[model samples]
Target: MSKTLTFRHVSYLWDEAKALELAGNEVDLFIYRSNLLGADLRLTNYAGGNTSVKIMETDPLTGQPVPVMWVKGSGGDIGTLTKAGCANLYVDRLHALKSRYRGLEFEDEMVELFNHCLFDPKCATPSIDTPLHGLLPYKHIDHLHPDALIAIAASKDGEAIMKEIWGNQMAWIPWQRPGFDLGLKLEQAVQENPNLRGIILGGHGLFTWGETSYESYINTLEVIEQASEYLEQRYGKKSPVFGGARLENTDEQTRKNRAADLMPTLRGLASSYRRMIGHYTDDARVLEYINSNDLDRLAPKGTSCPDHFLRTKIRPLVLDEPEKLAQKSADELKAYLTGKFEAYRADYAAYYERCKHDNSPAMRDPNPVVILWPTVGMFTFAKDKQTARVAAEFYTNAINVMKGAEAVSEYVGLPEQEAFDIEYWLLEEAKLQRMPKPKSLSGKIAYVTGGTGGIGKAICEALLQEGACIVAVDRNLLDETQTDLRKRYGKDNALSAAIDVTDVATINDSLRQATLQFGGVDIIVNCAGLSISKPLAETTQKDWDILQDVLVKGQFLVSQEAVVILRKQGLGGDIVNIASKNGLVAGPNNVAYGTAKAAQLHMSRLLAAELGPEKIRVNTVNPDAVLRGSKIWEGEWAAGRAKAYGISIEELPAHYAKRTLLNEEILAEDIAKAVRVFVDGSLSKSTGNVLNVDGGVAMAFVR
Candidate 1:
């Protein structure tokens, strides 16, 4: 049999001269370009797909008039069609013509370029799909061969596939020609079934329609999305996972909930390694992946899409134990790459050789996109913070689609060569490029009870990098209008409250005000507790009560209140307690601070475990002698620093940095990065974990 459709070519004419006489004005060319881009992405290798829409105009006297149809004009590839490529024609005449020859052959009509038998000289030729659109009652219609959809349709038992996936919500039409024949079949199908949402054209393409342009577009996509989701679930494939709006205008509560889930795991992992994870809390893929059942599943069947290959790899690198897990993941990646692409290692060789052509540029890291651990699931690999985030996004989306495809059957994606080409292609090179990211805590909502101190400011700025919105609480009042911190972050995102962390009533009221002003708090980085770096020998009973009230009791009251609101909202929230590194490893002079921090750490762990069932994740960051810009850093540290390390007070940070393997100074940004990670998705599976942000100072006892 002859093919149902044939390719054709057409180009646009610069008809800007007719701009003055048009009804409803000329459709913007940019929209057409965007549509073309979307279409190409959906159906690059597929054929026999189409798209159309209808436009309306007012009647002179009747005050209501019939609408005109402007389908994707004939004789052009939708892959490259511009606004000028589409034609508008009379809807009534087109419908009348289609009424006859309802099941005719494709060669019935012959019209000149930009001309129609019923169209006036002023009008363009009706699209070949005019009849199809006219036959349907919807105002807009689109058809495309999305790869994710095709993957399922091309599989065995495709009809059974529709029944299982759509659950009889969709109308399945056998393959038919694209002209009058298909139009008539669609009309009959619709009349036979009034409640049909859209038709799975079967081995051809999908067809979705709506009363409005945008609705039609979204509906068309939604059908494919639902189907793709089903398929991924069975075969274990993922689609583009993380491409959320990263604007300042997103829902604060949702972002905060994400941060809450992400922070503890991130801090725990980074503290263990003295390295940072993701940069932002709302870094798209990280948030979605964290929320995915796939990630939470005991045995995840890998990723859902091809683009995820570069970031998440074909499947998540599952790890239960960090040290052994890292090694196992690396080995598995090497083996998979070796087995799938025999001569492809030569590609890596060629790539490195090519890089050698330029001496200034650094060699690219050969690590795959992400490493997934059992408790600390999903770590991305990037040369810098931004690149790592992009890779994470790609991996998350790809994994989602891949998982969705798996539900239909085994997911066999585009060949390994295609994946390799996309990963190494120069077109995708921009993803690896890094630019200075916006503040890490830019849009994050943080509640800091003791905000005026050295530790509080440092924590605030750290939250700033991950784009967090900060709520700075201090017992002392200051002129809010004079500062740039509140002004730059927006008074809405950053709020200053005068309340003591120890006062339960004041904290309760302050939290309500902060939630109302900033929407809700996601990361509660408690830096308000008191600390006395005194020896255990001289510590008084009164000093211990005061410290515990502020550090331990204060945290409990604050976290419990936040959890109530969080549970009602149905999104997982986070709580980050600022515990001393001494809590994890001991310190000689300071007894109360260490004890309180240790208690705080236990509380975080307990809260994380208890809240796990409720989707609330809590954790603590234990920092070692955060003295640089802190008030405590300036005080008696001169004497204690000398006593502890036999060095001057100025040499403590350097002394601390040297204690770690990486030998990097512990910038407040480092701790903040950990906080963002905990709030991102680095430790998605972790809650009751503690992160040591003290330059790996105490590694004697490992978790």
Candidate 2:
């Protein structure tokens, strides 16, 4: 095929040296090619495409050469594909199953039989698109979901456009739910046109094949590049994309502030059925679509590709004009959004009822996965941050598809019945059912003050392991700690902010950052504190003021700002104050520090009572002599306390431990475990209570 139009094209990334390095090994070359294609989002989305290579291997039982097909496994991303991540199957066995194919209605039954054809019984589970690769009569095959190709495939005149672009070099197939029957059709099409190098699945994706992996890789890129160039030429000629912008965007900061303010209420509404973590994006393309006149007309039609809508749901909930929405008070805006949510739920239920078959799974949560707010951005919610973020990305891909289609021809969405079939497909339902149960704090977002310090870092990690997204707040931002948390968990699951919690403005700003990063906060850990040990006669006014400022005032300010977001969510949250054992036990020369801890303890009880009606629980965890990892102990507090005890600084931990009933040294992790128990749904009903994690300090026990 030849192209007349000139535009920027996707770079051909196949390295001759790399290919030559794995010349004799087809599987390795296949993996290399798959990774290269998947490296570009324009070629495929994360885990959205599959690739396969057929190679001859010695049969383990027969000692004879047999053809085996290695394809991307189910739930595996092509970019990250590994040898273990590929499902290996017997090609002859796969082809033999065609005799058992009953028809289109029974094509799903073929998936179960694929297990019988596995070349390795221990191999990864094959994807639903396995037959799309296995049935094709080629050594290498690629099935990708590229926005440019999907644009043509989803256009009203998709077939005609294909004819104009490639004539008979590429074949066009109408929309069909992927299964054994679709694979049979692909085989038939290729057999009839021996010269065909690719096929476009209307309203879906693209398929291309070659005798070698490099040939297939080049063919896939060539097809997408030509389509993109053609679309660009047509796009440039169009006077305005998406019927031109209908609303002017406010300043970027104003949009972000408004988005932050709106997120908690939106998240609460989305979580009405089940809790959902959220992700927000104001990408240029997202803003362009949200501000366009075509948004109302295009957004409700939903997405065309199966991969796009599967993550983004069929249609998004688009809010009213930004100018008008900005005028409403917080309460008024929330009430209005509540009504919108109810209507959306009803509509989704009705759609399920209208299209469900006898074996259809129960209707899922009816909340919109994607929410569009003009002048602000897009908000996507799911059971976790990564899913929510991916949903937003898929919607952005859908927007690109729509823009391209509209530039050349009218954009078309999947037919309602077709969309419903894919959404509620039995196989899809089984996949959903097979997912592992959520962790303790799966969808919760937490704000941990002093998160870079010993106790604070432990709290962050513990919460993260339980699946909560963490916003690590501290007066001193520690890049190493934040990087480690992010790397250990996912980047989205951990964020760090520098703020003086004693300053209300900084406290508000930190909470706002938390809101924007992870929708909103459901748990607050007031672990930020300081200590000043001194006899009353020797203590200075500055020492007293600083202790109170950080230990008492800081907790109050952080809690106060965080409560604003919690109340907006209406999801009843947890507030765990890390008080000191000195608050309950009398200690010589520890007046200022002990007094501040006592104040923090009482504040938790008072807030617990005040916020009880809102379902926000407040509690305290007190730890004594956490000298091993404590920042407080790194200062004069340890030396002062040791001197008061008439012991060397090195002997402080042992001395404190010997005083406890259990005679155990308290660690920061021990304190973290106490905090976890309070918020991990184990003690949901207990609040305004204190837990002593001081290795059994009898005098420090809560009465």
Candidate 3:
């Protein structure tokens, strides 16, 4: 039977003009080509691929021309790679290291030698795959983990399929851990078949090369485009992908709500070893895979691509069916999930025991990084949001690979031992060990109401600096604040939303967005409020109602909604209310605002008492006169306070400072620091407590 083929082609994105512009510098042209390849995720995942170019550089010590290889540095993504992000090494030295190779058992020692070969001592560190490029005789090389090619490389008959697709033009190499040995294998393959254009590493990825950077880039794309076409043709022939749907997909909103409801529990479970931030996706492709009949069969078989499983784990923990999940009460659901989580941990432990070598690093977190719920979607947990999101993306890539492979032939996962060795590999462990210590609030998610306001923004920045993912909730979201936050902290680390804490619907929506954005909220900062300073006689019913609505009711509603998630997560959380010193001190022209502040103070106490059983701590930070950068002081409140104190508005800061024991002016950042003190694990044992950030206001001292 003639093999079916289709014409779904990947575009050749190389720009000859751009290439020509950078042609004078081989390294620049190589980086330019890498960026283009990485720009298309279909070609390779974020930071999953490596590219290289060989150039002759004058040696600084010898003052003689030497061949140097520039490849992507460790942990750098090609799409965003700069010249600084590339590792430059002496090509002759790299080849010389081959003489020291003591075979596969000693391949790992080669990585340490790479540092000695660096042309520049300050150059970015070399990656494990450096030998793969350096050992090759080709001028340019591209090693990518494209889904289409991997689909063929992962199939049971991948070698046969490779022959059918490229005939003798492409070669095949059985799975080998990326190292000097794999480099030698690649070198051997090319030497054996001088006419070959590329080689597919079985159950791993693709490697293509050329004499020039542009040719290498084009050849890589051509191979991927051909694989895509071949897969597309056969994919159509297979009726009902993934054996058709087993469960119907829930509507988008329903899926989101379900995910939100369950995320806290999932996150809590996944955080068994250490706290983990989460990312959820209900993308059409994810939903299709989750709802498929073959999900049970295919998902457990795990991912074939090393890059896919490195982030996603060997396999995912597939949750129960939608009907069963929907029917379970919160308690029942928790129990059911708890059981599943324990089983997954046990299985992971068993795998570790079965595969661990004497020198294997201690088994890391046994929690599942990726979890799939039948009707809802995929949930990925990691040390941070970016990793979680990338894990989901990798799994989605794996799903696509599985789909294509199943169409033409059976999908084959890396053998259990192979997957385990890669996961527990000494080199990977060293990389993990080299990572910087996580910030205090790492893996935490914080929701700050009135987030665009001066104090709120400061609080958000403080929390973000400590590594918390921020959902900046405000009554009116500012584009500038959003842009600044996203730019500085990254889109995944910071989010801005316009929400009214008084409106339950808006509060619900914001929390839902938070849950979907970063799993669930671990910190609730009720900073969204307004103040009305008026003497008792002048304070109208309208003034009282609005103050109560925004200052008291807003805190209550936002806290009330956020607690649902906190409880579901079963993890202790922090709720810091930005109360005022007026709550404790008797002050003139502060009837409405003081009354609302008093309510907020006591409400925090009440919540702390009520939520103590659930380990949720609620604390209050009372600021007496936070003048600079406070929106409250930017309006009528400042004038009212100044008049009440018989001073000019400009004199208020000094006046308030003089009244304090410390005689120090309180700023918005000072108030923000107080909030940080409450939630930043500094006062973990304290609850229902009021901490004054008023430069030592005597009357406001918590009794």
Candidate 4:
């Protein structure tokens, strides 16, 4: 069997690059080939693999030609990589850093070398394996720890078998923890045979190099194809079809909505002690692997590669007494999970003690990244979504590789000692230390009404920017707003609900939807209301009832219902209501609108007093002259305001802007910012107070 690279895409890039200068031209070819390889699960799983190309550029400082390696960066995934994704490192300086490696400690020196040395001073941190590419003499390199190749690399007689299969074409080197020393080992292996096209790391992955991107990429395929063929010919029939993308069959509880129903319960358990997010999937592949009869034995055999232990723990946790898990109550299941997690921690501690070497780093957060429930499915947890998804992909591939290995020969993983060394390696530990602290409301959720436009949309956007999940409430679902929001944050971050604030059933149902999607709502903003302008002489019972129905009665209905759930959740909550300055000051024609807003102002205070014991804080923001784009100011309302002020429609905005002490018109964003200040607890001790977001309007100021 033979494998081939898809060169059509990269060929087009090269044809266009003939006109480009050498310094920045290598990036297009590298990006095209990287994306091509990354799109195939066989070439790269999640963010596990890397690619690089070295080119010569003139140094502006000295007018001398310098070698620059445009290597994949630390946090960039190859699938979506761009020219900005590569870290430009000076190849000569990277090699020179080796001289400092003699006396410095392995872990500390490697971290510092990757951090400080760069050909482009402003480039992001380079991959920890940059030296492996920099010291190599080839112009192009592709390094992917593909599953089929790993299956052979991780076998007991992996080297001998690789030699038998390919003779001198593939050189097998024994496993060493990744660092400055591993780079030296790769360099030696390359020098061992200049004719060699690929180097197989004993417990690591494959490195294939060539003078052009296409040549290097094709070499990877050839090695993988041969390895896949070897396993099939040896024991293809006996293999249990591991490493598939989805499940062949599913139980009742593992199907459709039932699987999604389990996410809130599992996420609540996963984040109980620490605050990690959960991503659940009963994909055919994950379900197939966990539900197999042989999973009990294979689940504890260690991970596919050494670097994997850093994200996924050394192995996944198989639930204790799996037969009794699915039928239990949510509380009972959570308690059982807690007990099982404690046992896992104990086992992890024992493993660490047995494997620690001198200068080994302290243990990291011990929560299992992957958890398997016998009846339901699998769930992966991490602090964010991308890492959780990546962990799931690695485990999915692990299932296939291990099963494929067993079919050929017994599966052999990296020794526990090697796993421990890589897990606590200084280079891997520093990535965590370098991350910036999270935002104040990273895990909180905000439910906002009137979310499509005016002040509602602004509040929704503001909350998402602060790391909180947003549920945008309106009279109907806003698909455009949802699409735009999902594009910015993720699909999980923004949601929409349809409800007339006056309807309790619709309001309660939407609240239930928010709870189901994200665990619970932590903040509430009641901004749904319409403006009614009517003079005392012209006011009808109909106008009065409509204004009161929306501003006062409707506001009460929505807030009280949300507060009921907040009390049950027992988590402290914040409620910010959008009020109007007309509530405090009245004009000749403001009979209906002013009175309804005044009732809302008092209702906020009453709720604050009643719910204070439950730790639910309530406040109000009075926005004046936010008429630039508000629906409230559209037809009859704008005409009425103009009639009261005795001005034409064109002069209405200027009149309001000069009415303020600061003489500036207040925008919807200004009101949104004021609402955000309240929710983030900047005014934690000052609830039941009104914030004047009218650019210093003297008439709206409260004493």
lDDT measured at residue 15 in model 4 versus the true structure, 0 to 100: 32
For every candidate in turn, the CA RMSD to the true structure comes to 18.8, 1.7, 2.6, 4.9
Best of the candidates, TM-score: 2
Instruction: Give lDDT for model 3.
Output: 0.89
User: lDDT score, residue 628, model 4?
Assistant: 73
Model 1 worst lDDT run, 10 consecutive residues: 1-10
Per residue, candidate 4 scores C-alpha lDDT tens digits across 502-529 of 8898887777667555645678998987
Give a tens-digit lDDT track for model 3, residues 489-551.
888899888798889999999899898899899999999878788888989999999999999
RMSD of 4: 4.9
lDDT of each: 0.55, 0.91, 0.89, 0.76
Ranking by TM-score: 2, 3, 4, 1
The lDDT, on a scale of 0 to 1, for candidate 1 is 0.55
Better of 2 and 4 by TM-score: 2
lDDT sort, best first: 2, 3, 4, 1
Which candidate, 2 or 3, would have the higher TM-score against the true structure?
2
Q: Count the backbone clashes (under 3 Å) in each candidate.
A: 68, 0, 0, 6
lDDT of 2 by residue, 1-703 (tens): 3422332667577789989999999999999999998898888888898999999999999999999999999899998898999999999999999999999878788999999999999999998899988999889999999999999999999999999999999899999999988888899999999899899999999999888888888788888888998998897476589999998888889988988998999999999988899999999999999999999999989999999989988799999977788698877888899999999999999999999999888898999999999989999999999999889889999999999999989899988899999999989888888899999999999899999999999999999999999999997756888899989998879999988987988888888888888899999999998888899999999999998999898888888889989988999999999998988988899888899999999999999999999999999999888988889899688889888989999998889889989999999999999999999999999999999998887788677
Clashing pairs in 2: none
